[model samples]
Target: AQTVTQSQPEMSVQEAETVTLSCTYDTSESDYYLFWYKQPPSRQMILVIRQEAYKQQNATENRFSVNFQKAAKSFSLKISDSQLGDAAMYFCACRSGSARQLTFGSGTQLTVLP
Candidate 1:
């Protein structure tokens, strides 16, 4: 069984700054995918970034990026030039290549301070 852990329960960032959210997982599978999903007040989970275990390059999308350390089983999300709209509950998730289900962390409440 695999599990995701998020040490920080909450995080805050001033507008236009950067914030990094940490995540680590325990898994025996060698092939899998890690993801960062953002759920705002609306409660819709949106995929922020994803990293494949076999890939060396970290995944990035616009202002969002991930620091994926496969060896250490660490996958963290970095939000740059943070906007107020970016405030949300972020969850770190993992899905094995053979499984369709996602095992998620408790979640980190990200507050963007003005």
Candidate 2:
């Protein structure tokens, strides 16, 4: 079984600043994918970043990066140069290599303060 947890229910960051959202997962499967998704007011799930269980290097996409700690089952997302457009509901998700379904966290609403 695999599960994802986001400790913070909400987060706020100043515009043009940075924010880090925390996430943790528990999975018995050795092969899996950890992901951070952002859902805006339109309710579209956009992939922010992803990390493969077997990959030793963390994943980074532009201003979005992840700090993945396999041993501790931690996958945190760092958003640099935050903008108003970045405000959304962020979710941490996990999927086993063999599974088609993704388990997601409750989500953390990000507020970008101008």
Candidate 3:
């Protein structure tokens, strides 16, 4: 079974700053996928970023980027120039091509202070 882990239960960052959330996973499959999902107060799950195991280069989306260490099974999300809008619950998820389900971590609550 694949499992995602977020050691931090809560984190805070000021507006216009940068924050990095740590995430680690355990998977048996070599071709699995990793994802960072953001859930705001509105309760909508949005994809922040994604990384495919086969890809050597890390995936990035605008101000969001991932530091993916394939050998260590670690995927961390870095929010550059963080804004108040970035304040939300970040969830680390794992999925395989053969499975429809996504294994998510407990979630890290991000509070952006003005």
Best by lDDT: 1
In model 1, state the lDDT of residue 114: 98
Local accuracy by lDDT, each model: 0.95, 0.95, 0.94
Tens digits of per-residue lDDT, candidate 1, 61-93, equal 999999999889999999999999999999999
With a 3 Å backbone cut-off (N, CA, C), the pairs that clash in candidate 1 are none
- TM-score for all models, in order of appearance: 0.98, 0.97, 0.97
Give the 10-residue window scoring lowest on summed lDDT in candidate 1: 42-51
Question: What are the per-residue Cα lDDT tens digits for candidate 3 across 1-114?
Answer: 998999999999999999999999999887789999999997789999999999999999999999999888899999999999999999999998788899999999999999
Candidate 1: list runs displaced more than 4 Å.
none
Model 2 segments more than 4 A misplaced:
none
Model 2 TM: 0.97
Per-residue lDDT for 74 in model 3?
93
